[model samples]
Target chain A: MKAGSPIATSSIWPEAPAAPPSGLARSQHKSPGETVAGRSAVTERAGRARTTKRGQPDREPGLKRANFGRGAGLPTLLLLPQVLILVFFFFIPSLRALTQSVLLSDPFGTTVHFVWFDNFKALFASGEYRQSLVTTAWFTVAQNVITLAIAVVLAFATDRVVRARSVYRTLILLPYAIAPAIAGILWAFLFNPVVGPLAHMLHGLGISWDPNRNPNDALWLVIMAASWKHICYDYIFLVVGLLAVPVSLMEAAAVDGAGPVRRFFLIALPMLGPTIFFLAVMNFIYGFFETFAIIDAVTHGGPAGATNILVYKVFVDGFINLDLGSSAAQSVLLMSFALICTLLQFRYFDHKVNYGV
Target chain B: MVERAPILDMICHAILIAGAMLVCVPLYFAFVAGSLTIAEVQKVPLPWLPGDQFLANLQTAWVKADFSRSFLNSIVVALGITAGKIVVSLLSAFAITYFRFRYRMLAFWLIFMSLMLPIEVRIVPTFEAVANAALPLQWLADLLHVADLWKWISGHDVAIALEWNMVNTYPGLILPLIASATATFLFRQFFLTVPDELCEAARLDGASPLRFFWSILLPLSVSNIVALSIILFLFGWNQYLWPLLFTTDKDMATAVIALKNLIPRSDSEPAWNIAMSGALLAMLPPTLVILLLQRWFLKGLVDSSK
Candidate 1:
C-alpha cells in the first residue's frame, strides 16, 4: 500500500527506528514485545526507504534512524488541536451541507422534513441556477485564459530582461497584494460610468461602456478585475518556472542558431508545460470560488445576474434569500467540483513527480 | 547572455515596462483620485496628477469609514489567524514527522482531505456551525435521544442545548480561517527535509521529543516559519467574505470590508476621492509587507503552491 501511493512515497520521513532510547536511564529496559515491534518497524522502514529512493533521490541519509519510537500519547496530544479544528470547521460542515441538501428545513429549523433529492431537483429546475452554471463556466474560463496569457508574456519578458528585472517583477507582482475586493473597487473606479477617466476615454472612442445597465459589460468588468488580481499569482509561478529551465538547454539552442523567439517557443515554453498546467488548475479554482468577493464589491452579480456565478448564487440564496435547502444542494455541487479539481491536481502532481518535471 | 541583441532587449524592456504600467495604472489612478477633490474627481476627464487635497480627502475617508477602529480589527484578526495557523501547523507537522504514533496517517489524511473543502463551498453550513459552535454536539445528543432518556428517567422535561456563537468575535473572524491545509503541508515538507541524524543525536543525548523539536527543529525552521507567516498574514488581512459574514457589528468590520462601506449606495454622486483614499489605505499593510519582504513572500508563495 505504501509503495503504490503517491502521497506515501512523497513523504520521505523514515519510519520509526527500533525503539529509541527513552529518557535518562530508561534505555536499558526493553521487553520482549518491544523488541519484536522494534524489529518489524526496522524492516518496514527498510522496505519503504527502498521504494522512496526510486522517486526522491534527495532522501535524507538519516532515514535509517530517525523518528522517536515513543508512546503515541504525546504525538496524539500535539495533533489534537488541528484535528479538532478540522473536524468542527471542515469535515462536519461539509457533511452537514451534504445532509442538509437532502433535507427540507425552514430558516429557524423548528420544523424539518427529509425530502430527499427535492432540493437538488428544484435547483436543477430553476432557470437562474442553470444560467449561473453557464455564467460560471464563461467567467472561469475567460479569467484564467486571459490571466495566464498575460502572465506568460510578462513573465517571459521579465525573464529575458538583463536589467531591472527585480523592479519589473515587483511592479508586476504589486496586484497580488491587493485583495480581490480592492481590485474590483479599483477597476470599478477606473471604469465607473460617471466620473471615470477610462470610461470618458471609452466614450471618446465611441464605445458605450456602462456596466451598470449592460449585463455583458458587468460580466466583463468582473472578469477583468478577477484576472487583474490573478495575473500576479500566475506571473510569479511562470517566472519561477521560466527561471528553472536549465541554462545549458537554452545555450545549446542558441548555439544551434535558434533565435530568442525560437528558443523561447521550442525550449523554454515546452519545459514550462507542467508549471502552466498547474497554474491553470490553480487559476480555475480561484475563478470558481474565490472571485465571490470581487463580484460582490464590483457588480454584485448585477444587471441581470450575468455575473452571478454558482458560488455567488450559493451566497445569495443561502444567506440573503434564506433558501437553506437549495443553497445546501448548490454547496454540495460546488464541493464536488472542488473535489474533482483537487483530484485532477493530485494526478498531475503525481505524474510530474514520477517523471521528474 | 545567450545573445547580445540590443534592439530585441530594448523591445523586451518596452513590453515589460508597458505591461508593468498596465498593471500599475489602476493603483496609480486610485492614488490620483484619492488626491483630488470630489469636484475634480467628477470632471469629464479626471486629473492625471495628484492634487493638494490628498490629505483632506484621506482624512474624510478615515473619519467617514472609521478606519481607525476597522484597521485595529483587521490587524488583530490577521495577527490572530496567522499566529494560530503557524502554531497549530507547526505542532501538527512536528507530530507527524518526528514521532511514531498510532492513527498518525489517519490524522494526516484527514488534514489532507480538507484541501477539498474550502470555506466558500460550505459557506451556509459553516455559518450555521459558527453561529452555534456546539450545534454538532447538540445534534449528536439529539440523535442518541439523550433528552428523551433523561425525561423518562427523571419524569421531567429535559433539553440538551449548548450555545456558543462565534459571530462578531475575534475568534469568529480568525479561527475558521486558521485551519489551513497549505500551511500544514508546507511545514510538513520542511520538516521532512531536516536531517534525521539530528533527531538521532538528540534522542541519544536523552532529550525528549518536544525538547529536540524546540531546541533544534524549531530554530532550523525559522526561515520557513517566517515565509509562511507572511503569506498567512496577507491571507488573513485580505479576507473579505468570511469577515463580511462573520462580523455584523460596525466595530468588528475589517478594514477591507469597511472600505466597501465607503462606496455610496444611493443615487447621489458617490465620494470617489474619499472612497479611493480608503481603498489605498486599506491596501497599505499587505503591500508594504510584500514590498519589504519580496524575497520571503516569493519563496513562500512558490513553496506553498508546491
Candidate 2:
C-alpha cells in the first residue's frame, strides 16, 4: 500500500519494547490518583531521560542524522571492500570516460594525445549524431505521451471497475515483468513481414506494412515496442495515483451536478498533476536509456538509422564499430544530459509531488 | 458508487477487460509461436493457437541451442551478481548507518554517485577497465619481475604476462555489473528507521557489533533484503549488452543474450519456433519472480525511487 504508512513499521520494529521507559510509563498510568503537578513532573523527567537514552542524534524526528556514532576504523574497514569495487567498476571508469572525452587515442590505445574537446566537437558536428539526438528526443516524447495517455485511460477504467479488479491488475501488470529486450523480440515476432500476425492483419486491411524498407515504420515499431513495455509501469503508478484521489472531492463535485467525466476533468486531473509530472520524467528516462535493449532487439537502429536513439548510437559506435573516442565522448554527453534530468527531478519535482495517500 | 451509473460501470468493465487483453497480445503470440513447429510458425499467417509440438520445440531449443548450459550460466551469473551486490551494499550500508566514521559522507557519496553512471553511459571505458584489470595476475607479474632481479632465480627466462582476461568466466560476467548504489541507499534508509534502543540493548547484552549485526540487524532487515534481492536478480537476469560484451565463449552466454544467437541470420531461414521457445525460457526466471514476489518487487521498485 501506501508508502510512508505504518504498515512496514509493524513487522520489524516492536511497538512496545520491554524497556525501562515503557515500564515507567505503565507505572505512571497505573497510579492515576497522584496530584496533577507531581504527575506532570514525573512525566517530564521520564521524557528527558528517554531523550538522553535515545541519544542526541534522533531528537529531530524527520531530519536524517548525519552521524550515527563516533567510531572510524571498524566502519572504514567494513566499507573498504565496497569502496574498492565502486572505484574499479564505477568511479575509475567514469573518470576514464570523462578523460577520454577530451583526449585522442589511437585505435589500439597504445599511444594517446591530448585533444581537448575535439571528440565532443566532432560528435556535435556529425550529422548522424545530431539525427540520433533528434531521434532520441522524438522517441522520448512519443513514447511518454503514448504510454501516459493509454496508461491513464486504463488506470481510470480499472479504478472504476468493480468485478475482477485484481485479475485485471495482474493481467495488465504482467508486461512490467518482461524485459525490454524480450518485449522487443515478442513484438518483432508479431510484426515480422512474412510471418507476423500483425503484418498479416495489416495486409488483410490492404495497408502495405514494411518496416524493412520504410524508416518511419521502423521508427514507429521500435517506439511502439518501447511504449508497450512501459505502459504497465505508468499504469501501475497512475492506478496508485487514482486511488489516492480524495473521494470527498469527487462526491462533492457529483452533488454539485457534475457528471463523472466533468468531475474527473475538474477535480481528479488537477490533483493528479504531480503524479503525471513524476511519471513524465520517469518515462522520459526510461525511454532515453532503458529502451536501448528494445531498440537493439527490435530494430538495431534500423534501415538507415531510422530508430537510432542516442543510447543505441553509443552502442553501435562503441561496441559494434569500436569507435572508442567518439563513443566515450557521446557517453560523456549522455551522462551529463541524464545527470541534469536527475538533478532537476530531485531538485524541483521530488518535493512538489504529492503522494496524497 | 458515486452516482450509481450502471451503464458507466459496464463501460468501465468492458474497457478494463479489453485493455488487459491488448496488453497480453504480444505474449500470447509468443506463447503460440513457441508451441508450434518451425514450419507451422513460418506459415504465411502465423498460428494463433497452440500446437502439440511444444515439447519438441522446447527440446530442440534446450538441446540444440545449448539453452540448458546457457540457462545454468545465466543462473550462476545472476546469482553471483545479486549476491555480490547485496553483500557489498549491505556491508557498506551497515557501516554508513550505524557508525560515525571519518569521511563517512565521502564514502556514501562515492557510492551514491555510482547511480548516475549506469553501464549504458560508460560502457566503453568500463569494458576497458574490466579487460585490463588483470587483478591478482598483475600482482603475480610484479612478483615475478621482482624475482627476476636475481640472476640465479629459477624460471627467469619465461615471460609472465597474465591478462586476467576474464572474458568468459563467472567473475568477469558478474563483477563489472555488481557494484550497485540503489541497494545501498535502500538499506540505509531502512536502517535509519530502526529504533536505536535495539542496538543499545544488544550492546548492553555484551554482544559485539558483528554479533549484533548478524543476530539483530540482519533478521530485522529481511523484508528490505528480500525485496532488494528479487529486484537485483531481475536486473542481473535481464542484462543484455553487458553479457553480450563480456562473454565471447558460447558456454558463458547468459540466456537473455543467448536468445538472440538462437535466431538465424537474415540470409538463412530462421527457426522461429525454436527461437520463440528460447525467448519463453529466457523470460521464465524474472517472470516467475515478478509473479510470485509481486508485492515485494513493486515495493522495492517504488521505494527505491523515493
| Each candidate's DockQ | 0.49, 0.45
lDDT of 1 by residue, B1-306 (tens): 557888888988998999889888999999999999888888879978899988998899999999999999999999999999999999988887777666777877788889899899999989988889999889899999999999999989977898999999998888888887777766765565567689888989999888998999999988778877888899999999999999899999999999998875547678899999999999999999999987778666765673
Q: Would you list the clashing residue pairs of candidate 1?
A: none
Q: Which residue window of length 10 is worst by lDDT in model 2 chain B?
A: B150-159
Q: Each prediction's Cα lDDT score? A: 0.80, 0.73
Best by the TM-score measure: 1
Clashes of 2: 0
> Which candidate ranks first by DockQ, i.e. highest?
1
| DockQ (0 to 1) for model 1 | 0.49
Error of 2 at B89 (Å): 2.0
Please report, as a residue range, the 10-residue window in candidate 1 chain B with the lowest summed lDDT: B185-194
For candidate 2, write residues B80-163 as lDDT tens digits. Answer: 988998888888888977776568778866886776787888888888778877644556657767546543566456544666
Q: How well is candidate 2 docked (DockQ)?
A: 0.45
Off by over 4 Å in 1: A1-51, A54-65, A352-357, B148-157
Report i-RMS for every model: 9.2, 9.3
Task: Tell me each candidate's TM-score.
Answer: 0.90, 0.86
Model 2 docking grade: acceptable
